[model samples]
Target: MPSVRVVSLVPSLTEAVAVTAPGTLVGATDWCTHPADLDAVRVGGTKNPDVPAIVALAPDLVIANEEENRAPDIAALRAAGVDVLVTEVRGLDQAFRELERVLDACGAERRPGWLVAAEAAWRNLGAPSAGATRHAGRLRAAVPIWRRPWMVLGRDTFAGDLLARLGVDNAYAGHAERYPRVPVEELRAAGLDLVVLPDEPYRFTRDDGPEAFPETLPAALVSGRHLTWYGPSLAEAPEVLGAALRAVYR
Candidate 1:
């Protein structure tokens, strides 16, 4: 069979396909930062990808995510006669399944070792339960994705799901919007046990994020890659993120 050429619009999927089958990617979005030395042609950002430029690459397929990529770009690619594979990952189970499907679509020779390790790591984690840590019971937290208008992980988000599995339940998981803008005052008064701060889409840091919350509220500064991404990073996320949360709990 002929080799498959792929362009990944999602950063996580870019790393996924790149690690699974190197050289298969001829084009990727500017945000596809993993694999550090990826040689794919940059087709702009995920939200505003250059459709004509992508078409010019003539990839056999383009992989995208429902949440990370815009629909019009996918539609435009299809209209340009490109075969685009769009994936949606709302939960851990679905993430694994989608990873397998994506690798298959990319014609990976076999399931990548990292993927196997990631699956085993999460599977062995068992279900989310109250930890025996100092702050007993499942830690309820508010995950802030952005500030200056203050957007947060609301209902049905991949990051929120991952947090839940780590025994950190999102405070806004039942909100109507997947990402809702809430007042900082309201967040402070939300009866949260902790505030989880990730380092992307906002780049929350020691000085930037922690200052927003009351001195009494515990703030767990974690990697946005682990919290928001669903690629090779998933393998070590539990350990990395767990340690961060544990530090706050202690």
Candidate 2:
């Protein structure tokens, strides 16, 4: 069978398809940075893609995520008669299922080793040992994705689910919106044991993010790729994220 030529609008999906079936991708958004030597045509950013450029690629399939992409873009692709596979990944399980579906649509012969390894890694993740931490209890944390206006991970977020699995509970996990713009003052006063910061959507570095929180609160400055992107990074997410979380306590 001729390989399916793919265009990936989502960064995570782009990495997934590219890593699992190299050369299968003909176009990817500018944000698809994984596999750093990716040779696909740059279609533009996730929020504002060059629709005409993507359509012109004539990919056999185009994969996108509901959160990272806009509806009008997906609709425009569909209107142009391009076969678009849209995925919604709210949690770890959904991410795995969506990865498998996206790969199958891309005509991958089987599940990639990375995908299998990612699943196994999460399954075998042991509970967080509080004994090693200065704070000896379950960690109630607030995950801030962006600043300026200060947006946070709220209910039904993929990152929150991963944190939950690692025993770090998101303080805003019960909030109404998946990503909510809460006041910075409120976040600081949210009675959090830790402040989880990732380096994307907004780059939260040691100097940048930690200063905002009270000196009493621990900060876990982590890789946003591992925390947010649901691709091969998932395989190392547990270890990378767990270590970051643990470091704040140690």
Candidate 3:
């Protein structure tokens, strides 16, 4: 087989590829920040990657995510004969399984240690205590990704599934769209016990986001990476998310 040369379009996948097989990544998206010192060509953002620039890198494989990237770009690259590896991860287990697939395609001789550690960390975690949920029933939370038009996590999302594992239920998990846009007033009136905010897609800070929520509902600002990304972050996702969610209990 030809020696693999990779270009990662997704930030999380970039971390995965770089850390698993260092020196193999020749190109990555501008948003890819892990490894901090990653040596690769910048391929623009996830949604608007420079296809011509990517083609010039002569990467044997270009890795992308179904949700983070646009279909037109993936088609354009494939039309140019680039072997595009498009992965879809909707939960923690899928994240690990998909990582292995991507790594194996890139010539991994064995499973990387971080992958093992990440799985163990999630497996060993227990759900939040009953009090943390506060609701005698399952914890109900509104998880927002954007604020301008106001979008919230709805159905079949990695973030939603991750929260469920911690015993925190998503208020809009049954909505048809994976990310549904609802007005702020609607969210507040949705009978939500709390609102979980993540800092990505839009950087929802402690000052900026929590204030938007109605005082009747509580809010917790969590790391966007831990809530969204599916690479090495998976190792501590359970703990990081657990701590943040538990804080809202009291």
TM-score of every candidate relative to the true structure: 0.96, 0.97, 0.95
Segments of candidate 2 deviating more than 4 angstroms:
130-132
Please identify model 1 stretches exceeding 4 Å from their true place: 126-131
Residue 41 shift from truth in candidate 2, angstroms: 0.3
| Clashing residue pairs for model 1 | none
Clashes of 3: 0
Clashes of each: 0, 0, 0
Query: Listing every candidate in turn, what is its Cα RMSD in Å to the true structure after a full C-alpha superposition?
Result: 1.6, 1.4, 1.8
lDDT of 1 at 207: 95
Using TM-score as the measure, which candidate wins?
2
Sort by lDDT, top down from the best? 1, 2, 3
The models' CA-based lDDT, in order, is: 0.89, 0.89, 0.87
Task: Give the clashing residue pairs of candidate 2, or none.
Answer: none
What digit string (tens of lDDT, one per residue) describes model 1 on residues 69-131? 899999999999999999999988889889999999999944789989998988788545434
Candidate 2 C-alpha lDDT tens digits along 1-250: 3479899999988888888888999999988898899999999999999999999989889898888999999999999999989999999999999998998999884578998899999999876653237545678889999899899999999999998898888999899999999998998888988899999979988899899989988888999999999999999999998888877766
What TM-score does candidate 3 get on C-alpha atoms? 0.95
What RMSD value applies to candidate 3? 1.8
